[model samples]
Target: MSVDVFTFGLNHTSAPLSVRERVAVPGELLRPALDALRSTWGAAVREAAILSTCNRTEIYCAAEPQVVDQLPAWMAQFHKLESTSLQPHVYRYQQNDAVRHAFRVASGLDSMVLGEPQILGQMKDAVRAANEAGALGTLLHQLFQRTFSVAKEVRSQTAIGANSVSMAAAAVRLAERVFGDLDQANVLFIGAGEMIELCATHFAAAHPRGMMVANRTVERADLLASRFSATTMKLSQLPERLADFDVVVSCTASSLPILGLGMVERASRLRRHRPMVMVDLAVPRDIETEVGRLDDVYLYTVDDLGRMVQTGTDARRAAVVQAEAIIETRVQNFMHWMQKREIVPAIMEMHEASEKVQQAELERARRMLARGVAPEQVLEQLAYGLTQKFMHGPLSALNRSEAGEREQLLELMPQLLPRTERRR
Candidate 1:
């Protein structure tokens, strides 16, 4: 079966946080997950890459057409979820549609926060992971190279990213809405990854009374803290220290919740029920869902931040048409490249056949010359032999074909055969 571009999975728009979180693949498991995907279908999945972020988990593959239907099942099984429950939220895109979806995704046209630049970095990271896992082959490599190019073109040629609200900025806005003013609020950041760094930058601007970073790695936490002159603490210290901050932002890779109800409840009691704002930007959630019900705690997940960032998107929405036009042109070009690639095997076979014919004819010419045959007659025989060998297939097909097929062959013969000018 011919391999074609295929993309399958769900994102923030198609699935809610609860569903997305269930299937989210952590960074540490990316290589194993990729190996499992390719191993599950073997040759059916020729080339594969899994792009798993807090907002989406998509598998891009160069695979047989039949593999598309089975991909959702594989994803559900990989994540240990029931296929029936996950199938409805899944989407599949093939060939040109797959190419367009990738371009749009890299260009941030498909993000919850439209034109947000963070997703591009996240995609690059996914591609890097795929490369490290040896999951990337020619097709996916080309696709992603073009994807990056298209993203650059969209960002440079259009105003899609301008005046766009970032998730980090949105989180700060949400905090202010709850706390009235950030000047007196102490902020706690969980994790020292990119999202946390972005949130730290934005919250730093608020000039909060104090800022602290809690991470599993003290070195990473200290590194992030050094930049903002904030303090650093270990994750083990969170239960005792969680109530010190009025606002908390967490984005981590842990598969389970970092802050459970009991911990937050204890923190609330420590604070004497002071109102607190907490943002959980991790996929599986760094904070437990039940903790949101606490009377003194204002908890928000990545989805809530996404919705908050979407509010002022009208200004950036104007650039969507222009970005999409750019993506359409690029998508057509990529599909054309793929179409040309499909004919390569046929072209190779024809060349191989023609080479064999030339070799056979040349051998006959050499034998006649060695036998003391006239050079002119030998040349004539060689030409005739070459012509006959080249024309045999077409002539036989034309003779055997029925009326309609013969007529079609006759029409194609002119283009398929090289023209010969008569000697005067």
Candidate 2:
């Protein structure tokens, strides 16, 4: 069975947040998930990597053709969901199409926020996890190596990322819409991950009246807070001090909602229904969905921010076109490499067979010499033997073939065989 490149997953465009969150494999679970993927399919899954982020949960694998269609079922089973529940949202690509999809995804062409750079980093992280899990093999390693190269080329050659409205910037804009100016509003950041750090950088530029970082780990929170000259707080302190902030931006890897409706509702009452802006960038969502219903709270999920960032992207359309062109070329190149790889075993077998034929002819020539045969005659016989052996398979095949196949072989024989120079 031939192993081909296969990609299966659902992104923001294909699935809602509700469905996405259910299948999201967090960073901590990535290796285990990859191991599960390989085990479930056994040898059918030769190599695998899972790229799960806030906007997508993609599994890129080098697997047999028969295993491609069953990937969705495996994903649903791993996530403890019914296959039917995920069937409508999932998308699959094979061979060249899969290569193109991977190139587009890494280049940020397939991202929720077009030209966003975060997905590339996330992809790299996923690759690293796959490597550490021993799930990476030659095919996937080469695919991602080319993926990163293509992404770099696209960014340098196109303006896809120029003047890009990042989610961090969008969060600040959302807050300003609620408060008009961040300079007078107190901003609170939840979690100390990269997204939170990015949000802090943007919000810090506004120089909010006060800034604070709350995380499960005080050390991490303190480290992030020092950069923005913000205070650090434990997550336990959020409820008591939640009403103190006018803006809250949260992104965490927690499997469940960190801020529930009851917590935010009480905080809203404590603040006398004062307007507060909240941004939740986590996949499963750090903040409760019902919090958006509160009269005093303005809550935005990752999807909401994705929509907001998509606006005013007309200027980047030309860059997108250029980037896609580059990606398409790279995809073709990668697929060509994969095709060559598929024929390698046949090429090796042919070499081995030829070597065996050469050895047998050499043995025959040595035996003829040992029996006192003429040296020149033995040389001529050796040459003849090699030539005859080389031509035997093709000649036999041509003879066995009927009219149509014989005609095809006759046309191909000249190219397949080496020719001697003709006398001038």
Candidate 3:
């Protein structure tokens, strides 16, 4: 059987964050998961990549059809979850559907925040990880290449990315709701990634009382802090100093929770039960879920931030029809390429046979010329011989074919033969 491209997983829309957090493969674990997936169903799965982000964790692969039956169980087992629990939220796409899904996702069409550009970078990261793990094969590599091209085309040609509220802006909005006036509140960002930088930019406009950036690497944190004239701290200081900030924003690539329930509880205690807003933008989540239950702590995950990012969606929606039209045309073009690629073997065979016929006729003409046949007659006979060779099999098949088969061949003749005025 032919290998087919497939994508399977759950996203923010397909499942709740609680479920997504459980199945999400963090950045560090993507390669391991991809390696396992490639060998999970023996030789069925040929190439694979897993795109895991705050709002989604999806697996894209080239595999045999039967591998579909085994994927859900394998994924659940890899995550150490019950297959039954994971099954209900899973969505699977095959071949063209899978190609379309990858393109839409890279274009930010399927994201929690429509037209969010972060996903494109995240996808590139996944592709890099998969390449590093040697999990990329011809089919998947081509699919992703085209997927990226289509995404670029969509973004460059359409208004899908215009007038959009990003998650960073949303984080700032959410903080405003709790603090009322951010100028008086001290804000601490827990990571120095692009999201944190964007958040810092929005938050700085409020002229907060103080701003601090905490990151695993002090150099990176300092670099970011320098841009905003904020202070920097090591990641380890969060436990003891978390109580000082009134608003906290975190977006990290950490595989495990950095801030646990006890840590947040201590912070709440130190704050004398004063209200504190926490935004956790990590996929596996930098903050513990139990922190959300703390009375004084307003813990918001990426999903919560998603709700606040819907400000200018009407504009994006207006462009959706146009975006879809562009995507559909690209999808058709890609599928047409794939269809032609599938027939390459037959095309090569036809060329090889035609070349052999030409050579054989030339050799016969050489033999006739050596026997002293006239040059004009030899050329004529060679032409006749080559034509006979090309048409003999088709004519013989037509003559021997049954009535129904002959009718089919007759109908196909126009396509198979070159049209001349006489034949027409």
Candidate 4:
């Protein structure tokens, strides 16, 4: 059976955030998820890796024939969802298409936000986790290695990432929409993670009247705060001070909602229902959904940020043509390698058959020489025997063909035969 490369998943285009979050595997769950994927299929799947981001949940694998089709079912089983429900959202790519999809994803061509650089980092992290889980084999290893190189090539060769609008930048734009002038707004960043640090930089550039970072760990919050000449607040102080900030941008690793409706309601009451903007960059969401429903609160989730970052897609669209030309060439190169690999077993079988014929002819020639037969005669016999043995299979196949096949084989026979037979 052919063990082909495949990529299967649902992304922002294929599914909404509700479906995405249901299947999305967090960083901590990646290793176990990979292990489960391999153990679930055993020998049928030779290699596997899972890339689960806020916008996508993809499974890349090299597997035997018929195994590629099992992924949707496998995913449904893994996520404890109905197979039918997942099928509409799932997409599958095989062989060249698989490689192309991976290259596109790493290059940020397939991202919800066109040309965002964060996906490359996320893909690298997924690869590392897959490597640690022992899921990377020769096919997957070469795939990602080439994927990284292709991403680099696309980034360097084209203006794909120019004028990139990141999620943090989007959060700042949303804040400005709510308050009109960010300079007059007091911005508070909840959680000093990478997204928050980025948001802090964007907001600080506006030179907000006040900037503070609140985190469960004050050390991390303080570290990020120092860069912007901002102050750090404890998570415990959120309820008391959440009312003071006009803009709140949050991203955290917390599993549960950190900012609930009750706390925000109290905060709104204290502020006399003054308009406040809240941006949640978390997957599970750092703030509650109910918070967005409040009269004076404006809440934006990661999905909201995705739409915000799509402003200059027209410019990025031109770069895509150039990027695709590079990716198509690389895809052909990768597919050629896979094609060579597919014929390996046939090549090995031919080698073994030819070796056996050679061994038999060599033994007979040796015996003929030992029996005082002339060297010239024995050499002639060995040559004829080896030639006949080599031609036997092709000759038989050609002779057995009925009509159309026979004509094709007759035409191909000269090409397949040695120069000596071709002359005959």
Number of backbone-clashing residue pairs for each candidate, in the order shown: 0, 0, 0, 0
| Model 1 C-alpha lDDT per residue in residues 1-424, reported as the tens digit of each score | 8899999989998999999999999999999999998998899888888888988999999999999999888888888888788888999999999999999999999999899898899899999999999999999999999999999999999999998888899899999998878999999999999999999999999999999999999999999999999999989999899989999999999999999999999999999999999999999888999998999899999999888888878888889999999999999999999999989999999999999999999999999999999999999999999989888999999989999999999999999999889999
Clashing pairs in 1: none
Give each model a TM-score. Answer: 0.98, 0.98, 0.92, 0.90
Candidate 1 wrong stretches, greater than 4 Å? 421-424
TM value for model 3: 0.92
lDDT of 3 at 17: 84
Q: Candidate 1 vs candidate 4: which has greater lDDT? A: 1
TM-score-best of 3 and 4: 3
All candidates in order of TM-score, best leading: 2, 1, 3, 4
Cα distance off (Å), candidate 1, residue 187 = 0.7
User: Of the candidates numbered 1 and 3, which has the greater lDDT value?
Assistant: 1
Over the stretch 328-359, how does candidate 3's per-residue lDDT look in tens digits?
A: 88888878877888899889999999999999
lDDT of 2 by residue, 1-424 (tens): 8889999999999999999999999999999999998998799999999999999999999999999888889889998989888989999999889999999999889998889999899999999999999999999999999999999999999999889999999999999998897789999999999999999999999889999999999999999999989999999998899999999999999999989999999989998999989999998888889999998899999999999999989899989888888988998899889888889999999999999999999999999999999999999999999999998999999989999999999999999999899999
lDDT of 4 by residue, 232-336 (tens): 889999989999999998888776789999999999999999999999888767898999899999998888889878877797899999999999999999999
- Give the lowest summed-lDDT range of ten residues in model 1: 79-88
For residue 34, what is the lDDT in candidate 2? 92
Residue ranges of candidate 2 with Cα displaced over 4 Å: 422-424
The TM-score, computed over Cα atoms with residue i paired to residue i, of candidate 2 is 0.98
User: Which ranges in model 4 have alpha carbons more than 4 Å from their true place?
Assistant: 216-222, 233-237, 420-424
